[model samples]
Target: MLTIKRVETVVSMHQQLEQVPGCGRDCLGNCCIPGAKLPLYTFGIKQTLGSNKRAHTSSDDHCVPGDVGDFNDYEADDSPQENYFLDELLLAQWEDRMVRGLFRYDVTACETKMLPGEYGFIAQLNEGRHLQKRPTEFRVDQVLQPFDPKKFNFTKVGQEEILFQFGPSEDNVSEFYEKAPVLSSPNVVAINVSPIEYGHVLLVPRVLDRLPQRIDQDSFLLALYMAAEANNPYFRLGYNSLGAFATINHLHFQAYYLAAPFPIERAPTTRVSYGRKKGGVKVYELSKFPVRGLVFEMCNSLEDLSVAVANACVYLQNNNIPYNVLITDRGSRVFVLPQCFAERQARGEVDQEILDTQVNPAVWEISGHIVLKQRKDYDLATEEYAWKLLAEVSLSAERFEEVKAECLKAAFEGPPSDSMAQPPALPNGGSYNLLEKEQAVLIKSNIHKANSMDGVVPNVGEVGVEG
Candidate 1:
């Protein structure tokens, strides 16, 4: 693996404020004005609210929009609102970090386009009684440490507009993104977005067309490889289907990069437990933090890896886990990792019945991780779920043929929307249309999924929810 140099990037708060592409800023100004409680990516990352006056203005020391940490207390904001008693905790963190020279201000990307009925969507956080148990720690999730932008040792990097500027244009990059929606074959373009704690980046197709539900192999993997290569690479990548946590109606992929090593679960665990299983070797442990142990027995080939994953999940399920599984080949052996389900239960915020009750295989459309709703910096369980979910729906030889058949069926079943694009390449070895694919993957950011899956759900028994 190539080593990525950890270089210090000096992004100034004032520069970020004035340098924001006038055209890129959404009409609602949700980017800087505060829309949710979570701080996606902060310029002055090392700083927080009420930290140092040198990093930021004393009066404007708090978050630009509003100090939104825990989302349950999310209130509608037209402009900056004077809040402290409720926001003090979160704001202080940002300010505190600012006092120290840890993190700083940097420009960010997010889904800013608001549809006809999109304004009040952030107001729909079901803090009330939901199926899944909400974590006690999550109670304060509505409030979190804010991002300070002053600490960034600003040294003009000079003329770097093209780096952040993405997406296809009808006029500007017409040559780069030529294929039109109607003119191109269906299922040719695909888009997916995710939002995690801190580490965040937007990955999308270059085309200006709709996003695809299922992509072919080469194109899918290429998309990941390409986006992973972006400057502000995400620590953890995420994808939300049309109505599944997808805040934006546009086609794109939102990645959570700040909170790398995934610090969501309480005492999040990353130890590779070793042991044995039926199919082959086993590496199973508690999913959501404070791990129990791991079991790695044996491994002969890729098939063994696949079987081991299945076996591990079966064991956890028999233990009444209803857990999440992440399977990957590690040194010629398949590694099966299990994240137990207790954090959600402890929080009294998880919906156990939603998976079985509201699951709609047909309309459920993009399967895998469909059950994912809320995400946090400490919830290792949520992190594991995303990893496993990606494996379940990713493009591969085993399921691409089956997925392709289903994508075709969905296409013929209904009229395509501008938001919908062409067939996506599977996860394995296919290629992406350099131009159109780019535009099709365009998206804002984590504000990506305020509440797109309010009533939608995924099939609990089965992971893949195809046509």
Candidate 2:
């Protein structure tokens, strides 16, 4: 096992190499040095907020011509009214929610174009870097400091104490309940504190405490339901896994309003029926997009959509793969990005040089925009550079194809019967009625006997003071 001391030593060695003369500037250190061993290629967030800021700013700075007027009008207001209503619904949820003051409602819609040289740069980088034969593994408990739920003291009633609580168990229901003002309990939609766009909101399960890392049928259905309800020509819904730019571990889906569609939304479908499952979801591969991912058109029936999403989540969870999910309201299409770079970083496999850039691509970045914190990074950022950053964090073409194939198979095959992982029980000791059929199959298949694993899924049944 890799110990903390060993990890620190390895980091120090890389830092020392960076200081060596003629070693910086993408030489990737020691790989070029005679008799030096080649280091593993890994990626990480050097500056978490830096990349996020860049993404947020890019939205405004690169607004499409038609959308520029909306941004200008928003920015022209000396003190824009915080109260925004979506139809008859008011954003009154933000009034008393925790972290309400930190929310940024004003959004600028900018469109970033891919540079001609982006493909070439990405190819060159991929050819230069040697892929690791195996990924490094570490225990979350060993790496992460114990979480203190109290660190976030926001005004939302009952939420101040449960903001960072480990799971969504019964004990935390009240606290987690207070985190977001309830929007629609039946559909489980709630207004999020952080607003990348004017109508940014979250869709969560009404009774499950499962985290985003392990999505179940109930959460998936709720997300689909909420997205469908919010469907319009100007709204998009998305999800980010625990390591894939998700600020919180809780299971939630985000929806935001866009004056104009993102590049991905408008991009023509390159390949339809890239992969499909009989009586299941059809996968489409978008052509010429900087990020590599698959898109699924929502099924006509809720049962089919639930099955497809459940199987997709099962495949991802079983492989320990992290991903980002996006649902377009206009097309009823869902985009899934199986992420490798972020997962590698979580496993302590990323290199120092990549981390130094502080570029982490979450849902926004994958959707065709990026955020850069430093002036140097922002100024240096081009279409080619942005694509290069994405390529560094994205799965290789061959691996992506393999993942796509497996996901298709899973959707049709209906999850492996031999797998021990079971759907999490609901909060009130009641199972999701919508998923009862799948749950019954698991029970008959004896999959529920498997012990709920930590990191893979939250153990909601057990309640103990973590610290």
Candidate 3:
């Protein structure tokens, strides 16, 4: 069991301790001031306080001093409990809980190396076998299969396949649902049966929808609420769309608590304003490493968050674009990635085998951490090789510019007036529509100029698109 304790300490020798800089008070708020007693507690790490003599030394030299009093006067509740701070810090005692079970897998099993050139880093995940074995050849007609409650079981809770009854009426029922969940209400949060990382979790809607696009604002907000409840800076929340490498058809979002930051988290980002929604939710764009995507930074208002996400969903649905979304707890930042680039790569038209894997670009892969299942793929994985793979899976310069333009246009003018707008043609001889003809015309003209000057298109894996 992991036990974390915070102890209070003070200076024993008044003469040995120097007065706090710029403050006239002593170790005890105002020990030198007669007839005045101000209680102040100095919290320090238990490991640092070596003996009883050293325990009395001031933990922070800059802390203002106060009058010495009975040590018991400062002793407060030391009972094991969980405390979540506003700064995304979590303090918890795991002595009485089964916290040891949470870390059954070895985190160090995955190998990470920074690739050369533009590919930031690649994590050769030997534990990605679960994802590789998932069914990827579902028939188009069977894409939206109905839920079967009899087949559903909360196996993690128990060995028995417990059945769940959704509602009083037979018609108002769910075929399958999680009987035991970590967090539940309109949505359910449960531990992933096959987690890539320790404490990896999934947030799914109770109503049961195959596609994430079908998730309503209520369910979306609930998932975000559950993520915030984690309160740990290590955990990051994200989602993959239907065709954007989501293995399960059920509408769900994923969360994982990592000891270290993902490459994307540390990568540099350039921010650009995409304007604000009618409800005042500010929409923006973050480009460069990680993956280029539209961002919606929400305020405290739930209504504003709904509006921002609703607009983004409507835009993608209208354009027939599959996408992935990620929500970071730190800044309340939402990343919306249209899977145009990934979809193109899935065709396997290119001969490039660099960082090739069975799975397509998903939320984790787009976030600069590509997982390799095959031994050959893992062996060939390098920084430059990883960068090339991501570049191929990422939106091209021209396509990205068009996407940014459209998002900004939608933000200012409101959700598209036409929800039935057909996707435009692709640059290559394909039916894929990433932009409208007129928009493509302008983008192609700019591309032509850049290509003419350099004899090759700039940012063609050389650099990323500017925000």
Q: What is the TM-score of each candidate against the true structure?
A: 0.27, 0.56, 0.56
Runs in model 3 lying further than 4 Å from the true structure: 1-122, 127-132, 137-186, 207-213, 276-278, 300-303, 408-467
Question: Which candidate model has the greater TM-score, 1 or 2?
Answer: 2
* Per-residue accuracy of model 1 over 1-467 as CA lDDT, tens digit each: 11112223322112233444332321112232222122211111111111111111112111112222322222223232221211222223322332332222211211111111211011111111123221122121111112122221111111121112222222321111111212121121111111112222334442223333222222233333322222111122333332222333233344432211111211122323233233443332223322222322233333343334333333332223222221111112111222222333345544544332222211011212222233321122233433332333223343333432332222223222332323445455434443444334432221242233232222212111111
Q: How many residue pairs clash in each candidate?
A: 118, 11, 16
lDDT of 3 by residue, 1-467 (tens): 23212212121112223444323323211222223211111111121111111111112111111211222212122322221321121111111111323222333344544444443454645554443233543322222333333332221121110111111112211112222221111233444534454445565544222222233454556455444443343556777755566665555677765444445544434445455325555655554553567766554453456556756655654565667777653324466776654456557654456424654667877766566666767667676656556566566667877877776565446565665232223345443211224323422232121112232111211111111
Q: Candidate 3: lDDT over CA atoms?
A: 0.42
Cα deviation at 379, candidate 1, in Å, is 14
Candidate 2 to truth, TM:
0.56
Cα distance off (Å), candidate 1, residue 158? 21
RMSD of each: 22.0, 18.8, 24.7
lDDT of each: 0.25, 0.44, 0.42
Question: Which 10 residues in a row give candidate 1 its minimum summed lDDT?
Answer: 118-127
Task: Report the candidate with higher lDDT, 2 versus 3.
Answer: 2
